[model samples]
Target: MTITVFTNARLLDLQGGTLTAPSAVLVEGDRISGIGATDGFPEGAKVIDLAGKTLMPGLIDCHFHVVAYSLDLWANAIAPDSLAGLRAAKVMSGLLDAGFTTIRDLGGADLGLVRGVEEGLIDGPDLVICGKGLSMTGGHTDLRQRTDVRPRCPWLAPRQHGRSG
Candidate 1:
């Protein structure tokens, strides 16, 4: 297998809390093969001089919301599949550019959005989405009422046909 080597890097060792000078790294395909100094570099390997730039692993964002609105949370709660997917793609690019290589979507996402990113149908973060949130009737995310007014419990509505407390 062919190997690529990166040399002259300033390594940020997060676990050891040390900034190493003149560090080296080896990449066999997409995965990192080893890391240390160039003195041990294998023969006939491609080499890259990092020129003393810091080298670290990609960043991660544990909590993210791909579909969100500043003024209308209720509207986003009921957003259509197409629009939600589009929003997810846009947000994913922003997060990736900001150095977040992975994310865990806490809410407001369905499997289709995640699948779209995975299948390359959209450009977005690596997503782990909770299909939907759980909320009681008239609770924080209830969207049964008109956007201009507070939501009423379906059971409490005069036209309701279900039991109520």
Candidate 2:
């Protein structure tokens, strides 16, 4: 088994809700095996010096939007799902870069993005996705021109099917 030790890390103390003293953390594979003062590390373990920097658990973003690239809601609504899905993957990757290990996507993220992240094909946050966002009639996402028409799913607003409510 391969082991990596992160040294000089100021870890967060969950019990006290504070940053703990500089210490060592042992990681075996994907799991953290131990954390303590650097006294007894097994031989052949790779060591990384954190240089007294802070190290803690990755953050979770409760609300994330992987779609809607522009303020023009109608245009975004008309975009092909494949295009939106690709853009969502990029957004998820940006979230990961921002230290969000997990994200709850409010809308427009799909199973493909989740699978990509799981398969390591795309670098992205752990995606917790709601298939799509629905709005009420004349609600926030109803951005149709008077001459436009869209098919209304059961959950979609009346405006989507060209019915004003």
Angstrom error at residue 27, model 2: 1.6
Candidate 2: 10-residue stretch with minimal lDDT: 154-163
Local accuracy of candidate 1 as per-residue lDDT tens digits, 1-165: 888998997888779998887888998988998888677788888998988888777787776677874348777767887876677678788887777777887777778877887898877667787767678867766666646575655877877468876
List ranges where model 2 is wrong by over 4 Å. 14-17, 145-165
Report the C-alpha lDDT of model 2 over 20-125, residue by residue, as the tens digit.
8889999998899999987678899999999889987889988867776677777778999878777767777787888899989887777888898999988888
Question: Candidate 1, which segments miss by more than 4 Å at Cα?
Answer: 43-46, 69-72, 78-80, 136-165
The root-mean-square deviation over C-alpha atoms between each candidate and the true structure, in angstroms, is 4.8, 6.2
lDDT of candidate 1? Answer: 0.77
lDDT, residue 103, candidate 1: 80
RMSD of 2: 6.2
User: Candidate 1: lDDT of 56?
Assistant: 72
At residue 115, what lDDT does model 1 achieve?
82
